[model samples]
Target: MKSAILQEADAEQFAEAGFAVLPGLYAPAELAALLRTVEQAPVSGPNFRRSQEVFAIRDMVGAVPALWPLLDTAALRQLLGQLFPTGCQLVKAIYFDKPAGSNWLVAWHQDLMINVSQRTDQPGFGPWTSKPEGVSVQPPVAVLENVVTLRLHLDDCDATNGALKVVPGSHRRGVVPAAAIAELTPEATVCAVPAGGVMLMKPLLLHASNRSTGNRPRRVMHLEFASVELPAGLAWREGKRLMM
Candidate 1:
């Protein structure tokens, strides 16, 4: 399905609110196809997280090559171009499924870290860590400032279904201290999205989610894009640069 075009109002809203919802970005058929693909793919692995109520496919793009064509379609390329006019590349992608009975809850915080190919002693890049998916590092705020994350909702997401709660304009507070996160008093917004809608948010935005209390599952495909190239010797973990 064709992705929705990024409007000027969306750009303005993202700059001011740190996020913007692109309603009905994907057609119903597109969502159905994606769900089918997920069901058929051989994704069970160490990167895949499974529980009685929750299941997640981490590093989905890396795990399922067949999904690349759908993800890199022309419509999506155009949408990403609007956000990254200078040109951008895919950094990471993951699929999250929170079932009705899953007791999954994420606390309020910022996505301050990023995925890198390897760990190195780089100035301003610290708090390094490792994950089953890839190496993680806390890069400078400038790097994250240029990063945009698009979350495609496979199910209707609302407050009852684990929709993201974000502190609007928090992206402007570069590198907010963990202790100071609560100190920054700003009105939060619930990012409710439709089944085929998309939520565009900055990597530095302060956001979190609650456990689903609804009866249906809340599935989301999270894709992150960044235009900035890492310093020499440092590379993106996925490294699937878009040829835009």
Candidate 2:
């Protein structure tokens, strides 16, 4: 977790493969506590529609006191610092659950935009339009660059249970064309991880998941962070802050 270690291996992985999966990032008891919290928390948003396939609850860190320790852990903080030496702040947190018999699959895409607090013609922000789905079009590069995500796995993951698939080194190219991806290798690598492992990935990386054929469930706590700076008058939602 030292800066030297992270700079040598973790940062290299992020730059070359767009992600890094660090095993045993969380203790077994901690993982169990997180799962329990998710099971009891209120379900909200479109993420809850397919409870068996894809169920997500937001603001988990603030809701679960047990998880706050991870925020200050020396190893984790050092890794984050190495990942973003400039400084970073928590942007969002959510618990993602993929239950058995779940056929939810996410298509390959980039996390290139953010929901603005208000409408604006800001040059680096967006196409600036609202939609029924509540998602805005392409936001500025600065916003995307400031963001990073941590996906902590509470259960073992494998291809049978829809482990994440990502294109190595995809983040460097920015957003990839859908047609172009079809021609590239379907070499979707399976991210198999034991319980208590964590996967850190860039928001722009091309990643997705497949249906779960195994009887087990895949539970993950996703925590996203970004630098404090915002364009002009934009602001992050309250209670989203989880990091200094």
Candidate 3:
């Protein structure tokens, strides 16, 4: 765990840029151990989305228990408390690996959907989607606005290896149109983080990734946090309340 809180300047950067990167928070040994654990972690049955180009595991708490301690660390708790004073909990976890040969590319978009345990008719939530990935719904814009995402890099990521590209301050625009994304993405900035570093971002931040051209693996543990509660009996599918 890091010994100090995130710098106030970086916090301000996150507020304005909708994203921030903390470099070398973990040691090489720690990253090696984590990588070994992730390589051995059990994945969701055959439904696991594995391909020549990439592999993804959702609901990662059940699939890779070794990574759960990340949210429990005192440094992480302090960091979350600093960013979200009202308190936040882990609502989702996903592991994505862009392998050398896979040619997967994600287009510009905002992460507006959330994982829920069951499909319920809730006002302000609409157009529920269910696929092999799981059940998701577009929650209220307020929910997305309050959400924060952390991506932990297990390997060095750079533009050649599909590092994330984000449009600065786009989260402030709320939900945007597809045409707006097409127009704004040209101004996106690539965010490259070293192995053992973490990238913090807002859910509404417009972002995307290009295909890996350098043939290097980019493995990341993506975690989402939210403090809001669901209405009715609907619950977060992978939610785990952190002990702060």
lDDT of each: 0.86, 0.69, 0.85
Quick one: how many clashes does candidate 1 have? 0
User: RMSD to the native, candidate 1?
Assistant: 2.1
Query: What are the per-residue Cα lDDT tens digits for candidate 2 across 28-103?
Result: 7666666665666655543343344577655556555555664446666766776667767676677778887887
Native-referenced Cα lDDT, model 1 = 0.86
Better of 1 and 2 by TM-score: 1
lDDT of 2 at 124: 59
lDDT of predicted model 2: 0.69
Instruction: Rank the models by lDDT, top first.
Output: 1, 3, 2
Q: Candidate 1 on 107-221: residue-level lDDT in tens?
A: 9888888889898778899899987766999999999998999999999999998999999999998988889988664578799999988899998899999888878789999
TM-score of each: 0.94, 0.83, 0.93
Is 2 or 3 the stronger prediction by TM-score? 3
Error of 1 at 99 (Å): 0.7
Residue pairs of candidate 2 with colliding backbone atoms:
none
| Candidate 3 per-residue lDDT over residues 128-224, each given as its tens digit | 9997657899999988887899998998999999999999999999998987788888789999999988899999999999988896899998989
By lDDT, the better pick of 2 and 3 is 3
